[model samples]
Target: MDDDLRERIETAAEKHALLNAVKHESDADVGAIMGPLMGENPDFRQHGGEIPGLIGPVVAEVNGLSNAEKRNRLEDLAPEELAEMEAEEEADDSLLPDLPNVEAYDEVRMRAAPNPNGPWHLGHARMPAVIGTYKEMYDGSFIVRFDDTDPETKRPDLTAYEAILDDIDYLGFEPDDVIRASDRVETYYDHARDLIEMGGAYTCSCSGEDFSNLKNNGKPCPHRDKDAETTLDEFEAMVAGEYSSGEMVLRVKTDIEHKNPALRDWVAFRMIDTPHPREEAESYRAWPMLDFQSGIDDHLTGVTHIIRGIDLQDSAKRQQFVYDYFGWDYPEVVHWGHVQVDAYDVKMSTSSIKELIDAGELDDWDDPRAPTIKSLRRRGIRGQAIVDAMVGLGTSTSNVDLSMSTIYANNRDLVDDETDRYFLVRDGESFAVEGGPDTAHPPLHPSFEDRGARDIPVGDAVRLESGDVPAEGDRVWLKGFGCVRRESDTLVHTGDDLDVVREGDVDVIHWVPTEGVQVRMRTMDGDVTGVAEPDFGDVSEDELIQFERVGFVRVDDRDDDETVVYFAHK
Candidate 1:
C-alpha cells in the first residue's frame, strides 16, 4: 500500500483499538478493531485479508496502554465516539426491571420513611434509591416521612430530621412532600379513637410480663373483652396522661391464636413520660407505635408502594390488621433482604457511630472512616456512584454482602476524566539534580488538553517519597522532566528523550518541586502527610483531584500553611 493509505489505515486502527479498550476497560482485541476500522473506512475492505497484518501492531500498542491512557488517547482521537459510548454505557447502567403490577394503579406514589435518629448510612440508602427509581419510572410523587414517633426508646435527634432530608436530596431523590410523625400526633390519636370506637382496639392495663405471657400462649389480656364505650373512655384517659408509662398501652384487636405471635394483638399506642425532641410532640404523652402510625400515615399520605427489608415482614402483617379495620387498602410492599456492606470495620449503625463520635474516636457522622452517606460525599464519592451501586443489587430477598471496591470502581469511571492530575509524595524528601529544565508543564487532565496545564517551576531540586529514591547506578525518568541517574548519593540529569525511557525498562517516577505545598490527606487507613505540587493550592475546596501514582482525593480545606484533603480511592 502507498505511504498515505498505510498511514490512514494505521491511524484508524489505533482509534478503534483505543475506543474498544476504553469501552471494556481492558486490553483491546485485534479482531474487534478490524470490523470497525474496515466498516468506517470502506476503502480498507478491499485489503481486508492484509488489514489484520497491517494493524496488528497498532492494536498491540493500544492494548499496552493503561485504561486511563487509552481513554485519554480515545478522547483526543475520537471525542464524539468516546462520548457516545459513555452515554450508551450510562443508559445501560441505569436499567431497572419494571415493577410488578405497575399498571394496576392510576398514579404510582412511593414513600421513604426513615427514622430520624441520625443521618443515613449506606444501608439506609437502599430504600430511597429503590423507591426513587420506581417513582421516576412511573412519573409519580415521592414522599419523605420521618418515623419519629418513639421519642423515648429510639429517641429522635432534632438535627437528624434535616440531616436525613439533606442526605436524600444528595442522592438525587428530592421528596415531593416531607412528613414528620411527631408533628401528626393528633392525627394518630384521632385514628386510635376511631379504631377503639369500631371495637378494633382497646386500652390494656396489663404489665409487660403479664401481656407477653398471655400473648406468647396465643391468648388475649383481660382488657380484650371490654366494650367500645368503656375502651374509648379508657383510651382517652390514657392519652390525657391518666396512666404512667408502662402502666397502660392500647392494643389492636387481632386473632389471638394467629400463627405469627408478633401479629397477635400488637400494641397500637403506648404512654411515654419522656418528652419528645420536638416541642409540639413533647406535650403529647401517648405515642403511636411504628406499625400503627406508619400504616395510618401510609393511607393518609396516599402512598401506593412500600419498600422495606425482608426482616420487617412482620411489620406488614401487624399493619394489615389496622388496614382491615379501617377498610383501607395496604400499599404494595417490596421487601429486600439485609444488605451488609464490608466497607467499614465498625458496625454501620447510627447508635454505634454516634457512640464513637461521642467518645472522641471519630470526628462526626461525615468522618472519612464512617459509612454514612455524608462521609461518602465528603470523601468525594459521587451520588451517581452510590445510586448505581445500590440499583445494581436489584430487588432480591436473598441477603448480600457488598464490597466498597464496587463503589470505588463505579466512582473511578465518573471522576477519571473530570479530575486533574497532580503529584503528591508522602513524607517527601528532596533530591538535588545536577542539571535539568527550569520549568515543566503537565496537563491538568490527561483526557482534556483544552483545560490547560500546571506550570511547575523547577529549580535544581525535586521532592519524591523518601522510600522511592533510586539506588546507585539506577536510571529513572522523573515524570514531566528529563531522565536522571543516581550515582554515589548524587543525582545526575541525562537527556530529555522520550524514546530512551520507552525503549528501555526505565522506571518513571512522579515528583514535585522542592517548594511544593505541604498536604495532610485523611484516608480510611489514617492520616498521610505529603508534599504536593504548588498548583494544588490553587484548586478549589471540595474539588476532586487524582494524585499521580497515589489515589483520588478531595480538597477539604485549603489554607496558606497547608492543604487538607480526603483520600477517596485508587
Candidate 2:
C-alpha cells in the first residue's frame, strides 16, 4: 500500500513479465513473483504477515495492467539488473528457531516417537517437522521410533506402522533410522531388571483402587519395602506367565511423599497378555508403560532433544526418576500447549477415528473429513505449509485456537503459482455460441503466460454450470473468450474485446466443451460430478491444479475415461 512498496512491486512485475517472455511463457505468476519481492524488501518481509494478505494487492495491481503495457514496462529493465534483483530476493531464511542446547553436544540427535495405534492426525504430524527442523538446524539425525507397547488399550496395528512411516516419508523428512518398540521388548525387560536389582523398582500386588489410596495418602505399599532380590524374582515370574493381569506391576521407586500422586511409585511395567502385532506375539506377558519405555529409549537411542505436548510434562517428571536412578542426564525437554484447529469438529483422536474407520462409518484414514496427515496430503495440503503453520504458532505454552483458513491460505500461496487453471462445469447445461471462435486458448496460469495454454474446442456448444448460465438478454464473459449475450439456450458472441466486457457489469463464467473429460470432484462436503477440459484427463495422479471459478483440487485417481480429484479449497 505504501508508495515505495508500489514502486517495488511495479519493478518486480515488469521483470517477472520479461522473464516469462524469455522462457516463452504465456503469463506471469503473481504469487511466484511476490515471493522473491517480499524476501528482498525488508519492509515487505516485515509487513507481509500471512501469504493471502501480503501478495493479494500486488497481484491485483500487476493483473490490472494491459498486456501491451506490461510488455512496454518489461523493456525498462536490463537483463543484468533483473538478475541482480532476483539474486537479492531469492535468499530465504530458516523458518524455525535455534535448538536450545546445541553447543553441549557433538552430534545432536532427535526422535519423533509415535505410538502406532492408529493413523496419524495433523497433531501427530507436528513431531517430525519440529524434530526435522532441529535436525537440520543442528545437522543431526532423526529417528522414527514406533512406541507400540500398549497392545491392550492402544493396540498397534501392523498396517498402521507402515502407513505412519509412509506419511513421515511424504513430509520430506525421511528418518535416518526406524525402530519398533515391540521388537525391543527384551531391551525394556533388561532395563526393568536393572532397576529392580538397583533397588529402584519394586513389584506391587496392590489393586488399582488400593494403589490409588496408598498414593493419595503418600504411603508406600507393603510391597515397596520388599528386598530387591525378592522383587526381581516376582518380576521374572510375571514375565514368565506366573502372574495374571492386574495381579502385579513393576513400579519404579520415587519419593512416596511426592506432591503429585500420579508420579509417586508410577507403574513401570504391566502385564498385558494381548499379543503385539510386530513381535513377541503371545510369548511376552509384560510391557513397559509409555513413560518408562520412552525414558529408556530416549537415553538408549541417544536423543539429545525432546519436544512434545504439555500434557506429557508429567511423563518427563516420572521419566526423570528412571534417569536419576541410572545416573544419566535427561534430554532437554520442551513442552508446548495444544493447538486447536477449528475446522475439525470430531475428536481427532486416533483411537476414536480408528473405531469409526473399522465400523465402516468412515472411509480410510485419508478421508477428507478426517484430520489425519494422510487426509491433508490427499487434499493437496503441502507438508511445508503444515510445517509453516505449526512453526508460525511456535513452541508456546499457551493454548492456541485457529481456523483452517490459516493453513488453507498457506497452501494457496504454495500451489497457486504452479497450479494450472482449467474449466469445469458442474451439472452442465449446453449453450450454443453464435459467432464464437473455433477454439479458445486460455493461459494455463493467468499471470504466467509462459506456461502455455489449454486448447479448448468451441464445438457446437459449450458446457456451463447450471448456476453459471446467464438469463436471456443478459451479457456475460466466457472467461478467456469475450463478451456474449444469452438468448434462450444460446450465447450470441458480442465481441472478442475484453475491455468491453470489463467496462460493462457482465458476469464472468468458466465453461468447458460439452464433450470433454468427465470428472468426479470429491470434496470435503460431498461429491460434485463435472465436465473438465479434455487435457485434464491426462493430469497425473497427485497433480495439484486449479479449476477456475470452482476451487483448487488434487488429482486423486485418473484414467483416460474419467478423472477423480479431491477439492482442496476455493
| Best-performing candidate as measured by lDDT | 1
Off by over 4 Å in 1: 1-94
What is the C-alpha lDDT profile of model 1 across 268-332, one tens digit per residue? 99989998979887888888999999999999999888888899999999999999989998888
Worst 10 residues of 1 by lDDT: 496-505
lDDT (tens digit, per residue) of candidate 2 on 402-441 = 4466567667778889999998989888988898788888
- Tell me each candidate's TM-score: 0.85, 0.82
- What lDDT would each prediction earn against the true structure? 0.86, 0.80
Q: State the TM-score for model 2.
A: 0.82
Error of 1 at 449 (Å): 1.8
Candidate 2: stretches off by over 4 Å: 1-95, 559-561
Question: Any idea what lDDT model 1 has?
Answer: 0.86
